[model samples]
Target chain A: AQSVTQLDSQVPVFEEAPVELRCNYSSSVSVYLFWYVQYPNQGLQLLLKYLSGSTLVKGINGFEAEFNKSQTSFHLRKPSVHISDTAEYFCAVSDRNSGYALNFGKGTSLLVTP
Target chain B: DTAVSQTPKYLVTQMGNDKSIKCEQNLGHDTMYWYKQDSKKFLKIMFSYNNKELIINETVPNRFSPKSPDKAHLNLHINSLELGDSAVYFCASVDRTNNSPLHFGNGTRLTVT
Candidate 1:
């Protein structure tokens, strides 16, 4: 079974400040990692994914994540955040063991203040 | 055009009632899924359909049933809804052939009163 852990429940930052959201996973098999952003009253949108090859994955909206195999972690980071960036972020994992199932983390709420 | 769309973005009904949420995908994906987000913002997969075939159940309560009449439509029907059933139901679709990212609908917020 694959389980995802989002270290922080909520993160507060001023506009233009760098932000990082930590995520960790536990799985015995190789898995696909993904980051999704959910705006208020909107559905979750894919930010980026780490399938294979590169450890550093860049996504839309100037967000990027580094996948570390040794640490079993995929942390999302942005050089700077905007007030529009405030949203709920989720880390998800999908492995061969769990067919068609994306195990999602509890989610980290990002509050970008001006 | 919306890649994934679900009807009745907001639903409020009394307990013990029966309701259904409709979903459709224009992405021409063969696989679709239903995910539930609880009040705490935790997401869990409830059902997945591939090529109109039921692929995963995920230990979801039998009260929830998924029906796919075609490749692009998957509808969820809940029987005997309870207060605990109040949550956001998101429908997503993906092309399993190349492992594409899942496209999600706006979601239906169901509130059981």
Candidate 2:
């Protein structure tokens, strides 16, 4: 079984401040990692994904994440945050051996204040 | 154009009632799924269908049933809905490939009163 852990439930940061949302996962086999953002009353939008290749992955809205294999972590980061970036972020993982069922973390609510 | 769309974005009904949420995907994807997000914002997979065939069915109660008449449409029907059945149900679709990201609908917020 594969599971994802989002370390923080809520993160408040001032606008233009750098922020990081931590995520960790455990799986018996190789897994695909993804980050999705959900605005208020909206559905999830893909932010980034780590299938293979480079450990560092860039995504929309100037967000990025690094996949750490040894530590089993994939943390999302942004040099500067905007008030519009406030949303609920979810980290999900899918076992490569299995089908398309994605195991998702509880979620991290990012509240950016202006 | 909307990639994935679900009807009745907000649903409020009495307990023990029966209701259905309809979902359609225009992305021509062969695989679709139903996910439920509870009040705490935890998203869990309930059912998945690929090429109109049931592929993944989680430990969901028999009260919840998913039907796919075709690859482009997947609908969910709940029987004898209880108070605990209230949650935001999201419909999503993805390509046949495993690496493709899911395209999600706005979601149907079901409130059991």
Candidate 3:
């Protein structure tokens, strides 16, 4: 079975400050990684994904993530965040072979303050 | 237009009662999925259908059943609802061939009394 671990339960940062949300996964075989964001009372939206491609993947809203194979990590980062960026973020992993169902992390709540 | 839509955005019902949540997708995707988001905001996959056929069925209780009328619609029917079932249910669609991203609906929040 595959599992995802989001180290930070919640991260608080001031507006315009850079932010990083850590994520790690455990899988026996090749895996696909994804990041999703859910705003207040809204559904989850895909932020970015990493399949069999470049290690650095860029997403909408100026967010990006790098897939580290050796560390088994796919951490989401943003050069700077705005108050509108406040939302709950989730990291998920799916097996490359099967890739049937995604295994999600507990989630990291990003709180951006003015 | 909403890419994915679920009816009864908020459902408040009594325990042991029966209820159903309908989901439809307009993206012409062949794969649809149901996911549950608990109070803590952790999303878990409940079921998935591909071309109206069951594909991924999680360890959900027997009381929960998913019916797909066609490739564009997937409905979830819950019997004898429990307090533990009070959560946000999200419907998503994806195109497996393109390895496309999953598009999610605004989720139906079900509250049990």
Candidate 4:
């Protein structure tokens, strides 16, 4: 089984400030990791993913995440957050051999204040 | 154009009533999935279909059923609604591979009173 853990439930940061959201995972087998962002009343949009090869992955909206195999972590970071970046983010994992189900974390709400 | 779309963005129904949610994806992905998000923001996979074949069916109640007319559309039908069913349902699609990210539709909020 693959499970994702997002520690913070809510994160409030001022506009233009840097922010980082931590995510960890536990899997009995190799897994693929992903980060998705959901705006208010909107569906989720993929922010980025870490499949293989690169440890640091860049995504849309200037956000990025680094995959740490030793730590079993994939933490998302943005140098400067915009007010429009305020949204709820989810960390998800899928076992490479487990068919089609994706295990998602209880989302982390990010509030970008001006 | 919307890659994924779902009908009835907001649904308000009484308990014991039956309701259905429709989903379609224009992205032409062969695999589609249904996920539920509760009030606490926990997302759980309910069903998945690939090439109009059921691939993954979670431990969901028998009251919830999923039907795929084709590779591009998947609909969810609920037999008898309960207050616990008041949550957001999201439909997503992928290319039926391991590396691709899933595209999601704007969810349908079902409120069973």
lDDT of 3 by residue, A1-114 (tens): 889999999999999999999999999998889999999999888999998779999998999999999999999999999999999999998774444567799999999999
Write the residue-wise lDDT of candidate 2 on A15-111 in tens digits: 9999999999999999889999999999999999998999999999999999999999999999999999999999999875557678899999999
Worst 10 residues of 3 chain A by lDDT: A94-103
Model 4 over residues A1-114: C-alpha lDDT tens digits?
777899999999999999999999999888788999998888898999988899999999999999999999999999999999999999998865556467898889999999
Candidate 2 chain B, poorest ten consecutive residues by summed lDDT: B94-103
Model 3's A-chain: what TM-score?
0.96
Ranked candidates, highest DockQ first: 4, 2, 1, 3
Give lDDT tens digits, candidate 1, residues A32-105: 99999999988999999999999999999999999999999999999999999999999999977777468899
Off by over 4 Å in 3: A96-99
Candidate 4, residues B6-78: lDDT per residue as tens digits? 9989999999999999999998788999999999888999999999999899999999999999999999999
Greater-TM-score candidate between 1 and 4: 1
User: Candidate 4: misplaced stretches above 4 Å?
Assistant: none
Give residue A23's error in model 3 in angstroms.
0.5
Candidate order (lDDT): 2, 1, 3, 4
Give the C-alpha miss distance for residue B8 in model 1, angstroms.
1.0
RMSD per candidate (Å) reads 0.9, 1.0, 1.2, 1.3
Q: Is candidate 2 or candidate 4 better by DockQ?
A: 4
lDDT by residue (B1-113, candidate 3, tens digit) is 99999998999999999999999999999999999999999899999898998988889999999999999999999999999999999999988877777889999999999
Tell me the deviation in Å of residue A3 in model 2.
0.3
Computed on alpha carbons, the lDDT of every model, listed in order, comes to 0.95, 0.95, 0.93, 0.92
Clashing pairs in 3: none
lDDT (tens digit, per residue) of candidate 2 on B48-87: 9999999999999999999999999999999999999999
